[model samples]
Target: MSTMSAKIVHISIDRDWREVYGYASRPQNMPFWASGLAFGLMQDGDDWIAEGTLGAARVRFTPHNDFGVIDHRVTLGSGLQVHNSLRIVPNGDGCEVMFTLLRLPGMTEEQFAADAAHVLRDLKTLKELMER
Candidate 1:
């Protein structure tokens, strides 16, 4: 197994956990903000697929629950599985949304940084959309 590293990015939202999770947990709502998945998701059995900027990817998101977890697994067309660990937690006066970018094997530092930036922008978009 290849070792992996993570870069954690987050934003504090001016909303309750339930509200935040309700908006973010829907896979169909992804393309509206997540640039990496600009094409959104298409349901295919128990999994969802996206013909996204990164290419065709099949995704499996964590089951719905009241805890505000939004984790997901993505299998790229190249067959590499990327795990995205995301969460929304109650904070004073609001909630905080966190996204963990896992650095996969063979990814260069520059690529990793770019990917992190992409995720940050996506999170910001999510925040703006939800807070609006």
Candidate 2:
């Protein structure tokens, strides 16, 4: 399995990072900023399942944030697996949010890089929205 990770720094903690994580982690919020082609959210028992189209591939979000991990599975098309994690640490005047995404076998490095960039952008957007 191929693995890739990226980090974003120097963000003010004016809003709860956890909440930001929750929002970004939601499926319905994808169309707001995610570069995905399509997105949807559905209830599966108690947990919400987030599904979206990233290009021609279908991706699913199975949140495990309670354990500081989020699992993403690409079922249709290019089958892939992603384990996501967000780490928040206080910096000088704000907090640093670090995102780690591990790509499982069948995923390309380019795809991971693109996803990481999109996620970082989404986090920045989330931070801005919460600070407002």
Return the clash pairs for model 2, or none.
none
lDDT of every model, 2 decimals: 0.89, 0.54
RMSD each, Å: 1.0, 4.7
Candidate 2 lDDT by residue in tens digits, 47-132: 44455554344455564455423345544444553445555544554455566655545558887777667776766775776567
- The clash count for each model shown is 0, 0
Please tell me which predicted candidate would have the highest lDDT against the true structure. Answer: 1
Query: What TM-score does prediction 2 earn?
Result: 0.53
List ranges where model 1 is wrong by over 4 Å. Answer: none
| Per-residue accuracy of model 1 over 66-121 as CA lDDT, tens digit each | 88899999999989888889999999878999999888888899999998998889
